[model samples]
Target: MRSLFGDLRGKIVGKNIKIVFPEGIDERVVRAAARLKFEGLVEPIILGEPAAVRNLLSSFGFADPGITIINPEDYPEYEEMKQKFVELRKGKATLEDADRLLHDVNYFGVMLVQLGLADGMVSGAIHSTAETVRPALQIIKTKPGISRTSGVFLMSRENTHERYIFADCAINIDPSAKELAEIAVNTAETARIFEFDPKVAMLSFSTMGSASAPQVEKVQEATKLAKEMAPDLALDGEMQFDAAFDEITAKIKAPFSPVSGQANIFIFPDLQSGNIGYKIAQRLGMFDAIGPVLQGLNKPVNDLSRGCSADDVYKLAIITAAQAVQE
Candidate 1:
């Protein structure tokens, strides 16, 4: 099997990034960062204790000049950074409170990005999703024009060049109609990154009022909201998977719809369906599902599945790196 990173590497080489490992000096983090450096894909910075970080890398059989180390305790402006962080959290943080927050891995990662020490960040091997995201929202924040953040995945088949996108699977359990629309718009933008124009299908159990339920209504409202927010997008919804991907079903069920028969992006109604649906496609359909790629942050930050292989970390690093803009 061709490694997923082998494909994405070309898309994001020479990009500089700082990857925060809260787990501190783990072999997977060291080895993957070393691979990123060896491949010239990124400038990898490891944030942890210098001695332990160096020892771990050496033990992992990685020796790369591109690797740099920093310890939060020894960081020149540790106190100043902590002070600024407290100031940024004026309403919610005290000096002691800021000290406690700095002790957290995710907040420290955000502090690194805020200080211009990194173009982007990726953490959360040992942390919960909420722990990782709260820091991003309160510290790194959303980019201009991005109101909310969501999750996306890129599903690619082996024998064919076909790639599909799915969204909000790893975040947003039961997003409101407007939030669902934002998820659709963001997922569409992410699809564009991988060169898909994205004929989006907002999925539901019902197909064009075939069933009357609150769940179906939610999808219908989201579809209308998406059309209003992104007028030029090729999108339609309250559709079934069959109607979205099958020509015959689309012809019979939604003949007038431009997106029904050809959906490059699938937006699920809720986390349960989205997560279950993507896994079914990956396992049964034999496709590589390439992310819980977090979107809508001021600076790009991502989470690893913890069950992730080293190459998985490497590839997401590239994707996250590519999202960064030089300052």
Candidate 2:
């Protein structure tokens, strides 16, 4: 883990990256911010009252955090940010609506990224995933040609060379064929960041035509579309987990695919499957699940589990900072 983050810091340090933490009142978020500052990982700008943040850090015995605290009620550029939010919404929001929404730290923090005052943002310690994601979807928006944002978890084994990516695990509940294709392409780009030569498998219960069902057809169509989108990418399937993982089974069931028997990236057919699959690998496989890293947004904004420890906040923030550098 030290080596993993050391490599990340080597790439991102001195780039002067700034990461915004919107859940300023959450102790885990604040503790992580303090550690990030102490380590000089990135400049952390926490959203809260200056005094409140100072006092909170003091209570944690971190009296000299040297981090920036921006109070929404007192930010000098509130008017500019509020108006910018309205314009970004393109009539979905009036100035009055923007005024109210920007007061919420998630909205304010996302605006800092939107305005390029911050490189990226991380939240969701105490907020729902939607609470943090809605602002990025509306404000930062997805990258051009990406219809929606997705998430990927980096599954790395300790003391081994094994690392894999699991996608669509935290966003896009029931993606269509087109949406699934987009997730595959986006996940591929993410894999490159971690230096993985992605061999994506579009996972499903059926392996090729071994079974026929509407859900199976969806994975098949998604696989076809993903291939069209990235013709050079090594991916295939509508395959079962066994066919994708076990060499013997892959040869028997899906011998023709370049991805069969050796897939490092797994794109789940839906959020339910994606969510469940990653958790199983994390808890049972004992892999270090380093993220539910948000991707496909124009700027990076990651979500932390509400039950996250300070270490979780610390690591995800590093990952978010790295994402900003990649952008």
Candidate 3:
């Protein structure tokens, strides 16, 4: 198996991906943008106050020729686009609030993608995840095959070069059965993006008929619904983690399962489990987990935790750009 970074390199090694940065310019963002530009990875578009953007760069004593600057103030489509987003909200948001929001770096970044001004967006260094995604849902909305938007984490072992995907980690708190199925399907699609033939495992605390709970039933029901939704996909569920990955345990627990011991896409029951599970794997197993990756939107719009590092933004920018190609 290829490393995740290897896969990213293959897909984006020479691609001229466009990225929207709403903060105009920050040192970290500029550095990553410059690196990507030099590597022939992406064409970065920074949106904000041009003077402030240049001042920030000069203050750092760095000059980057790779960045293209756009002033949000002078953007002719600002008011028109803001109203379009507000109208998309359908009374959920006021025009005043929407206009005020466009000034936000993340908001402007996503709107650029919405209007086809850019290929994709990467933001969230100064905003919450909800603050980042809400604008995307209100403006870009879901795609044709998508019923909902969710998140996924792509985890990889550097030594073994093995990779796996987990979904619903950053969104959908306690998804219903149908929603869980949606998460599975969406995650499988993400797995496909990285060239994986997905074998989905809907994880739970139980294995087959060994245990029963409304929660476990929810996972089982989700598996059923996902099968209905994607009948041709190789997927199964309501299995414990062991059964999903351990050949011996899976044989005993899920004798008839096609995904037993071979599942690479793990769909969690809820956000809490998915979030904590990926973190534990990252810290203890030393796996590189890339995401809380946004999926199912009409365009490639992603959120960043305020705690994210510059490297996170760079890699996620690649993911967002990949999403743009898919769209």
Per-candidate clashes come to 0, 0, 0
The digit string of per-residue lDDT tens for model 1 on 1-327 reads 255445556667654455555555566767778887877878887878878887788777774455778777667877898898987876788888888888786788788887788877776666777888888889887778777789888888868867888888888999999999989988888776666788999999999999999999999999999999999999999899999998988999989899988888999999999999999988999887777888988778887776777767777777787667322
Q: Which ten residues in a row have the lowest lDDT in candidate 2?
A: 1-10
Quick one: how many clashes does candidate 1 have? 0
Instruction: Kindly report which residue stretches of model 3 are placed more than 4 angstroms away from their true locations once superposed.
Output: 1-3, 13-15, 55-62, 86-95
TM-score of each: 0.93, 0.96, 0.91
Q: Tens digits of per-residue lDDT for model 3 on 163-270?
A: 889888898999999989988988888887788999999999998767988999999899999999999999997899999998999888997999989999999999
Query: What 10-residue stretch in candidate 3 is worst by lDDT?
Result: 57-66
If both were scored by TM-score, which would come out higher, candidate 1 or candidate 3? 1
Ranking by TM-score: 2, 1, 3
Can you give the lDDT of residue 19 in candidate 2?
96
The residue pairs that clash in candidate 2, if any, are: none
Native-referenced Cα lDDT, model 3: 0.81
- Arranged by lDDT, best first: 2, 3, 1
